[model samples]
Target: MQPIVHPVVGYVCYAVYARWADGTPPASSPAAVAVVAATLPDLLDQPLYHAGITPVGRTIGHSLLFAVPLVALVWLVARRRGQSRLAVAFAIGYGSHIAADVPWHVLAGDYHELGFLLWPVTPMPAYSGVKTLGTVGGLEVTTLWLEAVIFVGGVALWWADGRPGLDLLGRRFDL
Candidate 1:
């Protein structure tokens, strides 16, 4: 998945989850946390891989081994801090990211692409050639179209949900 898609998907998931669980959209803080969590894996793995520090783009950060424990720790800390919702949002975002990367490959019997999910226990495949941006001029027309649809839907949902996190930016910038 592209980095742009991840956070949009995360926000949509959080909105859906909140509407189901709390009968409303997520609040600013949890929404923000979820968006950040969605990108956490790439943030951690991409730099290292591009710099030749790791063999693949989805090593430790994409591993369930790392995510499960980290989320558990986040849950524990958030519970203590009286912010369990934040932890849940984080889990949803992080889990969505991992889920987005794996299921299609698994269904297609491309288990080799999923080696990163186990990390050290299952060595990641070596870095393949760089992936293109999936833009209109790029080769991945289907991916570009899918991402565009998802992004448009996500923005629509966010707007309908009152743009929950917009206030955070306004407050931060004194707008």
Candidate 2:
């Protein structure tokens, strides 16, 4: 999945969870956390891989080895601070990111890409070359279209939910 899609998925997931849990729209702080957490895996792994610090772009950061423990720690800390909702939001974002990366290859019976989930227990596949954007034309045209659709839908939903985090940014930037 592309980086842009991750945060949209995170926001949508958190919005759904918030409504289901409390019949309320997501608050700014948690919404922001969700967006950042959604990009955490890539933020950690991509730089490391590009630096040649890791063999693949999806190694330790993408592994359950990292996510499970980190999320548990966040939950523990947040619960103590009476901010468990934030932890839940983070988990929703992070977990959705990992899940999003899996389905496409799995549905195609390409299990080799899944080695990232195990990290040291299993070797991740080498970096695949980048895919061209839909406008430019490539094998990933369908993926780009799907991402675009999801982004548009997510934006509409966010707007319908009163644009939870926008006010926070506006206040900070005086926009």
Candidate 3:
């Protein structure tokens, strides 16, 4: 899961939250900040890759520990800025990233060496295997399949969200 995937997952998670939870903000709520905050940890990893402190896609950005605290920090900052609503949105989106990515990786058994998520305490290994849906001749067809699934899910989310009274918070937002 890269940064791009986080928002979609986060939105879907938010949708589910909105459907089940009374306090969930709708699409019109100030969710952009929270959504971005949820993805901020990964964005921070971009600089680390340039400095060689960590590999481009192998760092805390993909870890639960990092994502939770970062989102909390965002929430705190947003509170200070009088944008707590946005902070919550970011938290949902960011948390959604973890919820979606972690389990799948766990199930696939594809974690990498440097990708020790639990770190000093747990040092849990991540799944590093590529999940291919199928193979066409010599080429793997998993990528296309994954993309299609994501696209369909995204479309469904958009539709579900567009329904009346579907937005989590009633107010508008900016990310």
Candidate 4:
């Protein structure tokens, strides 16, 4: 999935999960945090691909090996802070991003790409050259259309939310 789509779905999942778990209408602050978490995998992996630090576009960053522990740490802190709902919301965002990518991975014929899901236990397919978004492996038109649909769906959902403003990068404002 594309960067924008990844975070959009993450925000929606965070909102729904928050409502389910906490019986709240998606607390603005936590939902804001979830959006960044949703994009963390690509955020961490891509620079490494460009810098020649890793061969694969997906690395430990995309693996449960990395996310689980980080989430566990966040979970612990959240429990202590009495904000378990927020922590779980972040997990929903992170996990949903990975789930959204699965279809594209399959369409690209990179079924073996699950090696990245295993991280150190299995070697990631490290290809040379910086990876771009939309289609994985090659120009798979189906995957491209799937991405388009997902992104458009996200836009529609955002509009439905009355365009709840996100002040994610500055002032730390959630609403």
Please give the CA lDDT of all the candidate structures. 0.84, 0.85, 0.59, 0.73
> Which candidate comes out best when scored by lDDT?
2
Enumerate residue pairs that collide in model 2.
Answer: none
RMSD of 3: 5.5
Which 10-residue span in candidate 1 carries the lowest summed lDDT? 126-135
Off by over 4 Å in 4: 19-25, 126-141, 165-175
lDDT for 112 in candidate 1 is 82
List where candidate 3 sits over 4 angstroms from the true fold: 23-25, 79-84, 111-116, 119-129, 133-144, 163-175
lDDT of 1 by residue, 1-175 (tens): 6778888899999988999998988899999888899999999999999999988789988999999999999999999999999999999999888887764455445678788889989988863422333356545544446667988999898888888888998999999
The alpha-carbon lDDT assigned to residue 72 of candidate 1 equals 96
lDDT of 3 by residue, 94-130 (tens): 7666665564454445554435354434454433545
Q: Model 1: residues >4 Å from true position, as ranges?
A: 126-141
Order the candidate numbers by lDDT, best to worst. 2, 1, 4, 3
**Candidate 2 segments whose C-alpha is farther than 4 A from its true place:** 127-141
Worst 10 residues of 3 by lDDT: 166-175
Sort every candidate by TM-score, greatest first. Answer: 2, 1, 4, 3
Candidate with better TM-score, 2 vs 3: 2
